[model samples]
Target: MNCRPRIRASLLASCLVLTVSSACGGGEAPHSAAVGGSPAAVVVAISDADRAAAKQTFETVCFTCHGVSGKGDGPGSAGLDPKPRDLSDKTWQASIGDEHLRNVITMGGAAVGKSPAMPPQPQLKGNPKQLEALIQHVRGLAR
Candidate 1:
């Protein structure tokens, strides 16, 4: 009896589970609206725990392209056509706001007239609060 069929079936099941989980808000928070049905203003509150988690996530995922210090000299930067953003530079960050950064992280830089090398993080979904924390952490690096 071949185990290949069973293994393939298991993999397919896992993928389906992940897809459903993502759609149902397993990790990300659901969007909310105001009383008038208008889009509510998002107020981002960055906690210490959220900042720490964001920092860890950045080190694991973003450090490969953005560098540990965000100097755009990561190991993957050598092969990239357009290098990653340098977080250490306040001048570059001056033009972009926190909302822009969050959008880039969630939707990729190409979505906002930036480099395509920056891909969207679908696997690493986070709520608006978590995103705000991550943005705050990145802003700190610019200083």
Candidate 2:
């Protein structure tokens, strides 16, 4: 089935979120854009609330495949051909960039040429605070 319309809708929704966020007058630093119109990294501050939510999300969803200890050996991972990644693997963590992790989290593993079983989190795509919080949590998992 064709997916262009859905892709367009998602893009439009993302643009709308950026526009609304920019107009809110909060102290948030500019995201994905910088002075003189240059492309830049998003700089959202992850709050305590964000961390709580991230933890909940990780426990409820991520831990199903990635174990509670981030060891990639959750009960659900039994007999899987390509097993879940060990989140605490320092070598693997060091090999990937944050943007790659972000894409895999929000767009699914298949988007990054990994297993299709890893689902996409479209809900988190527009929530940088939570996204950053989750990313930080993953980073902290490194052993």
Worst 10 residues of 2 by lDDT: 1-10
Instruction: Give residue 74's lDDT in candidate 1 (0 to 100).
Output: 85
Clashing pairs in 1: none
Runs of candidate 2 exceeding 4 Å displacement: 1-40
* C-alpha lDDT of residue 39 in model 2: 24
Q: How do the residues 1-143 of candidate 1 rate in per-residue lDDT, one tens digit apiece?
A: 11122224233433444444442134444333232332322343346788899898788888999888888888899998877888889898887765567668888989878898998975434365566667777787886
Across 1-143, the per-residue lDDT of candidate 2 in tens digits comes to 11112334244434445454552135443333332332224445456899999988888899999987799998888877699999999999998877777789998998889999888998988787788789888888899
Clash statistics: count for each candidate: 0, 0
TM-score of 2: 0.72
Count: clashes, candidate 1: 0
For this target, which candidate reaches the highest lDDT against the unseen true structure?
2
Please, what is the whole-model Cα lDDT of each candidate in the order they appear? 0.65, 0.73
